[model samples]
Target: MGGSPHTLCVPAGCSSSDDYTVPDALCGVTVGSEPLAPLLPDGEKSVCSVSVDKKQAVYVTDGVTDAETDPVAVQRDALARMGNPQKAAVGDDARIADQGGVAVGVCTYQGRRQKFVTLVDLTSNHPVPKRTADRRKALESFLRAYLPKAMEAKGCRK
Candidate 1:
């Protein structure tokens, strides 16, 4: 809300993508952090953190909606507007807000271990961002630029 239209812009900060090796345990992981696990009876691991919080519209473009776009304020407005459903059905015009944070984390997806830098939503317990191709590519691009400068250790290039 305090910031510009790019509210809660965390600046997409991340650790070095190449900061760590595959730790020998995950050397076979040729693929990135795509989820290889099967769907459980419960809806677990069905989402990624990289995607915007689309449960509801964070900011309504309605003339009466406030100009403030702070993450907390937006969430409050969105939930209130959507009647606080446990799960909200989003429409196309609903614009979600910035997420919890951005960082590179080592995670096991589909049994393959890989490093990924993307926005993570800690409040909701989501690990990485969404598994979409475009999201992955954006994370890869961030890592390519961030890892070199952040890690400085020459041997571990991505």
Candidate 2:
């Protein structure tokens, strides 16, 4: 948390200069590629980093060079797309919009601080479809493979 946030573009020798270590493992988990593959454009790999502090944590990933949106902003926009209501449940107090990219989850851990926000944002270079039904379905499929391990890595609990 002491250092500035940095982005890394893998295979291009980009470095993550932030205080946090990039959780590259998020990209290589056993999740089926079918759900995530189409969401990404051509010739991009799923790379990710975790930027975390005491009260919040964000795990963002994409197939491109850098994240185009902040996790909080992505969360807000995706939620707004759902008419600003807390919909869809993925265990814990998590809400995932049906538009296919951002999820907000509340994690509880035993400490002076009892809760924190764990945001998962899957940014894409390609524009999302206007209908979003297909994208939403794909996102849910991808999260089934990505979310549990990501939360564990973030030291979050349901």
Candidate 3:
């Protein structure tokens, strides 16, 4: 596997038992057994991009406000479910409300075999109902295209 130039040390006070690191400036880490390339956007520098090193994937945070957005909550809940499948039923309402409104991606690291979830905010100027619908559609499209590959690469089912 290829070595990643960036290392993300776990911050103090985190209760996770896994020792994970990510590239500098990335918000998430990847996991797998193969060499993973950093996901970069064309012609962009540090504003919007995602990168994954062996066994670790990193996503740059966009800092979109989520306090008033059900989609954000739905996305978070879904990721949590990925970590614990049993929790899927708990956030169904939020999930349905935010349907097609959230964006998600995954990356893998060959070193630790861990997958990280990446969420992108897609705020809409349309009315609340329309915005939510649009967001859900966009997110669903992204997941359909990229998620299966990521799951296969990471050896995860969800």
| Cα-based lDDT for every prediction | 0.25, 0.42, 0.30
Candidate 3, position 108, lDDT: 35
Task: Write one digit per residue (lDDT tens) for candidate 1, span 11-42.
Answer: 35225332111111111222233221100011
Candidate 2's residue-wise lDDT over 1-158, tens digit each?
A: 11222333444554433323234354454444344443333221223422233322223442211123334454576566543334445433345554344443444444322333334443432323333565565555556556665555555554
TM-score of each: 0.20, 0.46, 0.28
lDDT of 2: 0.42
2 against 3, candidate with superior lDDT: 2
Clashes of 2: 0
Q: Which 10 consecutive residues of model 1 have the lowest summed lDDT?
A: 36-45
- Span of ten consecutive residues with least summed lDDT in model 2: 49-58
Model 3 ranges off by over 4 Å: 1-108, 127-131, 148-158
Query: Which digits, one per residue and each the tens of the lDDT, describe model 3 over residues 1-158?
Result: 12322222344522332323322322232332111112221111222223221211222232222223444454666445322211111111212124222233222344332333334332222211234444344344443433444445444433
Q: Is candidate 2 or candidate 3 better by TM-score?
A: 2
- Cα RMSD (angstroms) for every candidate in the order listed: 19.6, 12.7, 16.1
